[model samples]
Target: MKFKTSLIALSIAAAITPSLVTAEESDIEVITVTSSRMDKPVSAIPNTVTIIDREQLEQQFRTTKDLSTIIGNLAPSFSPSRQKMSNTGETLRGRPPLIMIDGVPQSNPLRSGGRSGQTIDPAMIERIEIIHGANAMHGLGAQGGIINYITKKATGDNEHQVSFDVTMPNNLESDGISFGTSYSFSGESDQLDMIGSVSYRNNGVYYDANDQMIGVDTTQGESMDSQSADFFIKLGHNFDESRLELMVNHYNMENNGDYMAVTGDKENDIPTGAIKQEQPWEAANNQVTTTSLTYTHEDIAGQQLHLQFFNQNFEAVYGGGCWSDFYDPSMEGNDQVTVCGTGDNGESLYYEQSRNKSVKWGMKASMIANNIAESGINLAYGIDMFRDTTEQDMVVSGASWVPESTYENIAPFAQLDYDLIENLTLSGGVRYEYAKLKVNDYKTMYGYGDKEIQGGSPDFNETLFNIGASYQINPSIRLYTSFNQGFGMPDIGRVLRDGDSFPDENPSIDDSLALTPIVTDNIEFGADYQGEYFTAKIAFYRSSTDYGSRMVEKEDGSGSFVVKREKSVIDGLESNITAYIGDYDDVGVNIAIQNGEYDSNDDQSVDTDLDGANISPNRINLFWTHNFDNDISTRVQANFFMDKNFKDASDEVYSSFDGYTTVDASVAIPVYSGTLSVGIQNLLNEDYYTYYSQTVGKDTRYFKGMGRTATIGFTMPF
Candidate 1:
């Protein structure tokens, strides 16, 4: 019975949305046996798990390589893309998830720069696995969930592939054109396997529906007028009882600053526009390099042992503007009036940019013992250790925006799984974390009143646990429930950089509100049903945290300021249904319904509904796919976001978020021994602002969605 249910996932290989899973717990082959850090069946995963296989991923890649867009369309609970380089406001289940690649962390939770998603090109990835609720399985920073990108391996037969894709707006103008090219190869010889790939993309200027130039998001990052490249390689050797693999990945995205953003009138529905310029914005870039070596032994005293060591280097640059907080770095006394000289009207001009830089290295060692004591019980135990050094520095001024900070963490965990009976399974795990952060005292920024700020080492000790149960309700249905806890750190850099957060005279080192760690606990239950022609799933979850972080835009509009607030509660439901017509045709619908609120008055009671900044409105996606006799396949999907309106604790209405809709379609046909694919974005040319732009209501960042566009690609495998 379970084996039949597992066939659903293998059969619906091209499901575009977050769809059904393969319940191959013990009957069918383990579908998720690679790159999962922990070797286990998909059923062992407690919460909802969405697997985006290569087929669906390539189908999405036909339209756009922007991972955020792909995720928004595929993942049910993922927030809408901000349509910028930064992933800010792109929370999962109302909280930031831990983003990783090949079991290596890519997210910088300490500073929270929101650039994790773009660390690697999607072309190098073979699949994506998302765990829907908070958990400590991956160690730190899973307050929301986990998004792990599994890279392609070199274990297949000798193969080589090359592909090129080009995209342009409906007008077919040269300015709004983009192109990408990639070459990849994999070969297996004897005991050795090797794989490598290189890819490059160039994006031209972007235009809105009105045929106006879209403003460049210099502040975060932008895809417009940018160049991105990726290089990846992995080598592995198989031993009689062990396997060793070494991998390296280098990625870079640099924005070409060729225009200046001109603010618009939000009240009048005018979008921010851009004008051509040759200014120097070389500072706008994201560079990441990661390397890891893994060794696994299957015969270690009748147990499996996995060991890995990894290192990552990251740097990100944000646009600089002459704000009141910026000071001339050449001056010794923090003179504020230097970079952008006074204008004719005695107003400040734009000046310097800032960069977030960090280096991280970590190691993990784990052992799994099956059939412990012949009781049909399994135990998986491991220890994780990592260190990260992070800081934010001024790009042009060569000054420090946030002082150098170092963090160290060591954790040990144990997980147990047992089939209590033939029809019931129980799983539990525990992890203990010991962490420390060190920062030296430094003078505050000019906006911080030039006072000497005190910095000290802050340490933490925490323990998190998760438990789950699953019961087979006959052959075609399975029920699961879980309680999971996660731990994370606030965006310490936000408060530390703001001088206003500290008081004068004997300012104590303790600022619990902004510096405390955040802990979240989630309770979830769901059911899965697999039938001959119908597959469906539904999950409900409630998550809460005593101390959570929230961001509020400043009055001057320089940017947003972060604060640690009271209790926050998030409740949501995710469900999807798909009907199949034979093997090559299917129709599906997925919906995510969520609402979040927090205690605004600090009175120990929830009072305010979270705004768009922290939560996403309800969303739905509908799609259909068909394959004809001529080996031609076509897929179409439409996404809709419902309107959202909420108020603060004070009863002031904020963020009257109007809903919007977009449609996309793609087709692939066999041509000359290769596949020729074409994709259309905004097929109906529905003009609208992004959810972020519509909710924020800021003129400078009031960005409109992209206009109608088309993409063409050709792929050949040899």
Candidate 2:
């Protein structure tokens, strides 16, 4: 591959030219370990790493643009874009992880069934790295670990840029807008380089916490709107010295309000009486598309190389028609009768329509080798491939409910790394997977008879593994450990099931969607510190599973949504810190913590004890950033989310999520040259709710988490 991209551009210009001429004369590269495979430097990489720089996302963007809590200020009750029911559901250490951009593999396991919730739009991020555990060279779907997004590239400087943001709120007379523009060019001696960008966002309407108007399934009056458009392009070249690149990205989102599910009880006549649709107030719509290609090469003789390719496609269409499934006092005023009629009975209904589509493609290759003689040894290697597909159609045409399904998958991987000495490091990895599924009924193909006589065709295969170690006790300390094995498969809408004789023959119904495939075994340990004024990390974990996807009890206590492959276990701990309290170079502070449990037992029958499953065992974060002397600046952030006394493996019942603490603060100054800021979010006024059994069932009260919110902005870099 162009001689390993000229030996990784001569080993990253010989290890970054004396650390870029001593980074302002000392310290400024505390940690970074691109999930191992020899990018080594998170204290030699034994696991557990998180780096989100760019001045903490521009000081947390002042107040809120809902970066889904931006890692809960720094790990604590994370809600990576919470729209619940997977409107980009995200979690790490506490489950659901694996997200990458620059290295490809941008999760979309055929739509939310492959485990990693997908949603990208963090203003084309420039930095964000997390490794945690179980890498398996980022293949076969990482089991709760990995989130790498490093964008914004193209630098040869021939610039032109622009950015804009508008937000106003204080009792809803609303306003929210975003705009962007960019352009770049280079050719001093024809090393070639190019860049492009465009953006637009409307994003308005969100108010909850008794201020009302943030409804969807709870129907407390209504509102929620979103619109988006984004585009990007980049190209780079520099032969001989080695360097090649290409990129393209596109995004589109359109969401209107009011569309909720889980309907079942309206005095239950068997129509929609168990509905769990939260936030439903009345309108619906969704879309995404992306593309990418990258290549890197430098210092061939000493080794270093990288290549990546990517593709993404997404589509969503929800039914609209002022939908309401129930509320008929025997035609007390009849509005065309409406009597819909179906299963979870809110008086039985049909034809609410549905559409879902997803596609992903990726490829990756890397190699790094430096100073291999004198036994100082250093090496790195990697390989990966992916393909995912999903298509679901639940159109009832004239009212028949549920039909159409298809899912497919393909995966491949490889990895190896050996530092041997100098801080000590060793690693290994592997992965392989193939899958296929199909279902068609078209109402039994034409005659509208035989609709579904047990449709068939389900196939899957899998394999994955990993191993690791790291040690270093000098130059500021380091320690590491690892053990891994992960797997996942199942998502064609979880293999659509639930049908048993309505107008014809039945064979004792209950197919239970024949599910299986979800295995994990993770064990990790960590520590890395670089003191001169703090830079820390801590990790401890245990994950066990024999198969996942639960909720299946029915002997009366009610529950049906099967996928109980049995066995479940999770134990955890995570920590983070970034200090530098004095010396005025710009004071700083950051913190993080997480806890976990779900120690076995969950045979569906709900639950009665052994709680701690709804995640978030404990979390607390604190932040402070200051720099005032000419270009004034200030920031203060805090977060605390605790609880998860959760239980109900099937009817054991126990739920919890009460612990709460929120605080936010911000300030920035630098006019003319651009930059003006303000902040105040969730400063007390705490009234909460976020309990789910798949979309808000027992408690669906929300308040937009915008309690004391206030923001103002401006930016420039010419």
Top candidate on TM-score is 1
**TM-scores for every predicted model:** 0.94, 0.32
Q: Which pairs clash (backbone N, Cα, C closer than 3 Å) in model 1?
A: 322-350, 322-351
lDDT of each: 0.81, 0.51
Q: Give the best candidate by lDDT.
A: 1
lDDT of 1 at 244: 98
What is the Å distance of residue 9 in model 2 from its true position?
Answer: 21
RMSD of 2: 23.6
RMSD of each: 3.8, 23.6
Q: What shift in Å separates residue 321 of candidate 2 from its native position after superposition?
A: 3.3
- Candidate 1 residues 1-718, lDDT tens each? 1335554443232112376452322432255634335666665566788778888898898788888788878885788887678888888888889898888999996687878878998989998888887888777788888888889988578999999999998777898899999999999988789999999999988777766677767777777888999999999999999999999999999888887788978899888888887555454789999899999999798999999999999999887665656653345334542445654445454476789999999998999999888987989999999999999987756778788988899999998989899878889999999988888887767654565777788888889988999887876678899999998888878877776667657443454346777889999988776666666777889989988878776676566575656799999888777777777887877878888999987887788898776787788888898989999999999998888888888878766888888899999999988899999988887788888888764888898888888999999988
Error of 1 at 470 (Å): 0.9
* lDDT per residue (tens digit) for residues 101-151 in model 2: 666665655345322333455666666766654455666456666767777
